[model samples]
Target chain A: QKEVEQDPGPLSVPEGAIVSLNCTYSNSAFQYFMWYRQYSRKGPELLMYTYSSGNKEDGRFTAQVDKSSKYISLFIRDSQPSDSATYLCACKINTGTASKLTFGTGTRLQVTL
Target chain B: SAVISQKPSRDICQRGTSLTIQCQVDSQVTMMFWYRQQPGQSLTLIATANQGSEATYESGFVIDKFPISRPNLTFSTLTVSNMSPEDSSIYLCSVDGGSDTQYFGPGTRLTVL
Candidate 1:
């Protein structure tokens, strides 16, 4: 089984709607969770990051992690057309000299007017 | 967040040829990573580059197919050798930004024809 699993969603939503993206991992050693946004033909940009199991809010984006369940989520409030992109969930160990990131198949989100 | 840039943002190369993508960071970092993202797939790590040593590649990736160079803390390069259509993908370089975060460069989109 893959260490991380995410729904490859081409989820479509109208403007002003709420969006939820999620991922699950089997690695218990993962302590840092992150979400990234990538537009077409662009690189992945770090969107939200949380340490261990907890919730973190940044602007309209909120990230939640449940270590007990090995699951994480990103919530977007009042989604806009500009929010349309691929969202990737990534996890890694918190401490290491050379830490590597494990990524999940991204969820494609489209917010229409 | 560290600012990262990549050269030859998009390129079309003939099969059996080679292409080298360069990555430059705004600040020095201890470790750098190379990743490949094929169409509709998750980002897969190719290798980890540590300055002053040979790159450590992940399984299914090899030194001959994807040779990496980390001459210094702020710069690295990944060369896709003897390219094939299967090698066509977006190549990205990332720097560890401390605290479980990684900053990515604008990816190099490669197309093998």
Candidate 2:
């Protein structure tokens, strides 16, 4: 099984709607969880990052992690057209050196007007 | 966040040819990473480049295929050797931001025809 699993969603939603993107990981050693946003033909940008099994809120975006279940989520409030992008969930273990990240398949979100 | 830039933002190359993507960061960093994002797929780590050391590649990646050069802390290059259609993907470079975060470059989109 892949280390991280996410729905490859082209989820369409209306503006002002709430969007929830999630991923499940299989590695218990993963100590950090991150969410990245990628636009068309662009690189992935770090959106939210969480270290513990709790919710971390930054403005309109919230990242939640459940270490027990190895589940992570990113919630976007008042979604806008500009929020249309692919959301990727990444997990990382604390290797002594520079650690590599394990990414999910990414869920594509399109917020329409 | 570290400002990162990549050269040859987009390119088309023939099969069996090679393309080297350059990554430059605004500040000196300890760890640099190379990743590949194929169409409709998630980002997969290719290797980790550390200055003054041989690059450490992940499983399924080899130095012969994706050779990396980290001559300095602020710059790195990844060459896709003997490219094929399967090598057609967006290559991205990322820096390790303290506190378990990573900042990504704009990415080089390569199409092997």
Candidate 3:
């Protein structure tokens, strides 16, 4: 099985709607969780980051992590057309020596007027 | 967040040719990573480039296919050898400054045909 799994969703939403993006991981050693937003033909930008199992809120976006369930989520309020992009979940682990990041298949979101 | 500059932002090259993408960071970092993002897919790590040593590649990637060079802390290069149509993707470089949080480059869009 892959280390991280995410739904490949081409989710379409209307403006002002709420959007939820999620990912699940099989590794228990993951400690740092992150969500990235990527527009077409550009690099992925960091959206939200969380350490361990907790919830972090940044403006209109919120990130939640469940270490017991090995799941993480990103919630966006009042979605806009500018919010249309691919959302990716990534996990980082430091094995006490070296650290690396593993990312999931991105979820595509489109907010229409 | 560190500013990253990548050369040859977008290029269309013939198959069997090689393309070297350069990544430069504003600040020196301990570890740098190379990633590949195919069309409509999430990013996949190619290798970890550390100065004064050979690059460490991931499971499905190899040194010959994606040769990496980290001559210094602020600069790195990833060369796609004998590019194929399957190699056409957006290549990104990242740096982790001991905080476990990574910042990405603008990315090099390679279109192999």
> What fraction of the true Cα-Cα contacts (under 8 Å, chains A to B) does candidate 2 also have?
0.74
- Candidate lDDT scores, in order, read 0.93, 0.94, 0.89
Q: Which residue pairs collide, candidate 1?
A: none
Misplaced by over 4 Å in model 3 are none
The per-prediction i-RMS, to one decimal, reads: 1.0, 0.9, 1.4
TM-score-best of 1 and 3: 1
- What are the per-residue Cα lDDT tens digits for candidate 1 across A1-113? 88999999899999999999999999999988999999988899999888857889999999999999999999999999999999999998766677788999999999999
The better candidate by TM-score, 2 or 3, is 2
lDDT of 2 by residue, A1-113 (tens): 89999999889999999999999999999999999999888888999888999999999999999999999999999999999999999999988787789999899999999
TM-score of every candidate relative to the true structure:
0.97, 0.98, 0.95
TM-score of 3: 0.95
Q: Model 2: residues >4 Å from true position, as ranges?
A: none
Docking tier of model 3: it is medium
Can you write out model 2's per-residue Cα lDDT over B1-113, one digit (the tens) per residue? Answer: 99999998999999999899999999999999999998877799999999999999999999999999999999999999999999999999999998899999989999999
Model 2 chain B lDDT-worst window of ten? B36-45
Candidate 3's displacement at residue A76, Å, is 0.8
lDDT of 3 by residue, A43-76 (tens): 8888878886888999899999999999999999
Candidate 3, residue B58: how far the Cα is off, in Å? 1.2
Question: How many angstroms is residue A73 displaced in model 3 relative to the true structure, after the best TM-score fit?
Answer: 0.6
